[model samples]
Target: MVIQHGGRPEELRAAREECAEELGGEPTAPLADDAELSKFYDLQVEAYECLVANGYSPAPPSTREAFVASYYAGESWFAHQPAVPEGAPIPDTVCPQPMLADIEW
Candidate 1:
């Protein structure tokens, strides 16, 4: 049960609240890029390959039941690679503090 509405932060928040009222639970953000947020460009190669394999066509509109059937029917699909590039080292993503302990200036 995924809601695919597109909107701004305030609008999205409002929509989430409305949804929570009807659904009765905390809303979950789809954190798809948690594993390889830094290596997005590198992963695009594998996705391109998969897209080219399945008749090189875009996905068709369908219901949840139809979508599941289409998915398992060996239709065209995309997938990203697991590993990051060797030369492009992973970044240090720590949040910076407002004031430094030892200021020279």
Candidate 2:
């Protein structure tokens, strides 16, 4: 599943567990040990650094409860939004190669 936005660890872990339950299996171990998983993990670290460099996450941390509440509330709000009309424009960012390359993997 695509995690389109960011939130606290507790919420993220809970959602992953729920997804695993729906899939009829246990939540898989994180790729800390697997070679391919490690690559992506390193990439995420690089991505986060890039975000910080680009002024995306210099904000102070919120409490866990507040963070989870915000995620749930945001999801609820989005669910009630009207669908986009055809031909609407979308914006995206390319991952910063310099950030990824600077990371020690």
Candidate 3:
């Protein structure tokens, strides 16, 4: 995705390092070692990118809980839903407001 605004490369890098540490890795080590951790890491990175792209600085410890909650909620909902038939037209739903709206950045 295009990063239209917020966060320099160095800042994103630092955030990744911090996330790695919190997940039981060295700051410079890879973020994932298995499929489950890979999924978690991917979501975490996406959350970080979305936060910064929306012009909010990373809030670390506070943001982490919300991100994890949202990710799992979405995942659970998706897991229970039936898959669309191939070639089915996708629905155009209204985009929701920012998930971080309540956060004091």
Candidate 4:
């Protein structure tokens, strides 16, 4: 909703909570397995390298193990840090999130 609606994080978060409440825990799923993690990490690294090549500044990515641990802890990690100059917009071609194929998202 934030991507389309352009709302504050707090508002978006509250909306998410409201939606979750309405669902009443109707859906649940298991975490990704090791093979899935390996595949995703590989793709993420490639995408991060591409972003860096395009002049997007990002810190070195965490080790796959560390990243998996953090992922399980619900921590968010961005390959590119948002350091856009004042009054500047990110280029449409510069994507922070990787597009994964042949894998369930």
Candidate topping lDDT: 4
List, residue by residue over 37-71, the lDDT tens digit for candidate 1: 22332233333345445333323223333333444
Segments of candidate 4 deviating more than 4 angstroms? 1-27, 82-92, 99-105
lDDT of 4: 0.63
The parts of candidate 3 lying over 4 Å away from their true place are: 1-33, 59-105
lDDT of each: 0.38, 0.42, 0.41, 0.63
- State the lDDT of candidate 3 residue by residue for 1-105, as single tens digits: 223325788878877677676777654534322444335544445554554455444433224344355554454211111233342322213212222222332
Clashing pairs in 3: none
- For 32-103, candidate 4 gives per-residue lDDT tens digits of 777676677777777678877887666567788876667667563435534433524434366556533445
Off by over 4 Å in 2: 1-33, 58-105
Q: Which of the two, 3 or 4, has more TM-score?
A: 4
Give the number of the best model, judged by TM-score. Answer: 4
Using lDDT, rank the candidates from best to worst.
4, 2, 3, 1
